[model samples]
Target: MAKLLGLDKVATFFRIIRGNGGIFGSVKTLFRTDELKIGNLIGEDKYGNRYYENNAYFVGRNRWVIYADKVGLNYDGSQVPAEWFGWLHYKTDLPPNKDPSRPKYKWMLDHEQNMSGTNQAYMPYSTTRPKIESWQPPQ
Candidate 1:
């Protein structure tokens, strides 16, 4: 009777929710990421970004990342490091940790998220006179 009435579809929905983590956990994840997804944990980068992959999902949309809570809602694509950037965008089949050929040199710098709006962002100090300066009225 459940199948006849199509209530079976609802069961699958509940299963997905349960897989995400029961009702409360599911709701929390939904609010945090704006969507509920079930997938295998691909790997996590040094910045604490978590990568996920579910072939069940459509091609481009199958891969995703959940930024670490330390940054709260300030996270953005710029936070994704160059290495993970390639994997996240499907430029490579293997993740950084699993990619044996990835280079690591002594001069390599650590991951630092973009700071365009923050105090750490780059600020230029120019000694040269401006090509166009504001005109001053008789003082």
Candidate 2:
């Protein structure tokens, strides 16, 4: 019972710090209560994303992902691999590891996290010269 109580308190702390549960979540628990409670770890993808579920919470809201990289909390939705995405959304009952129907076609591409705001972000190359020339006071 004491351990349970301690866990509850911890959960409340995270809720308050993260502001996950909203005003009531913050004021009441001071931590995301849901986050603190232990949940069944569903699976982890190749990219280090972890999926978890707790039946105590509502079905849709119970499932969540703990991102592998902090990335300043700027993580994008695309970071979730295709297989894990299905599990998170309730589209499939089985996780990628257990799914029998999952395909392994040669053409299928590997998963890659989004790099939108980083130095690795996509940059297209063009051969055309600049339309607007730089100004020159005097040569």
Q: Quote each prediction's TM-score.
A: 0.84, 0.63
Q: Across residues 41-79, which tens digit of lDDT does each residue of candidate 1 receive?
A: 999988788999999899999999988879887778888
Note the Cα lDDT for every prediction shown: 0.88, 0.73
Q: Residue 61's C-alpha lDDT in candidate 1?
A: 90
Which candidate has the top score in TM-score? 1
The weakest ten consecutive residues by lDDT in model 2 span 29-38
Clashing pairs in 2: 12-29, 12-30, 12-31, 13-31, 14-31, 14-32, 15-31, 15-32, 16-30, 16-31
List model 2 lDDT by residue over 35-90, tens digit each: 44436788888777778887778889888886665443555789899888988999
Q: Which candidate is the best by lDDT?
A: 1
Q: For model 1, where is the 10-residue window of minimal lDDT?
A: 68-77
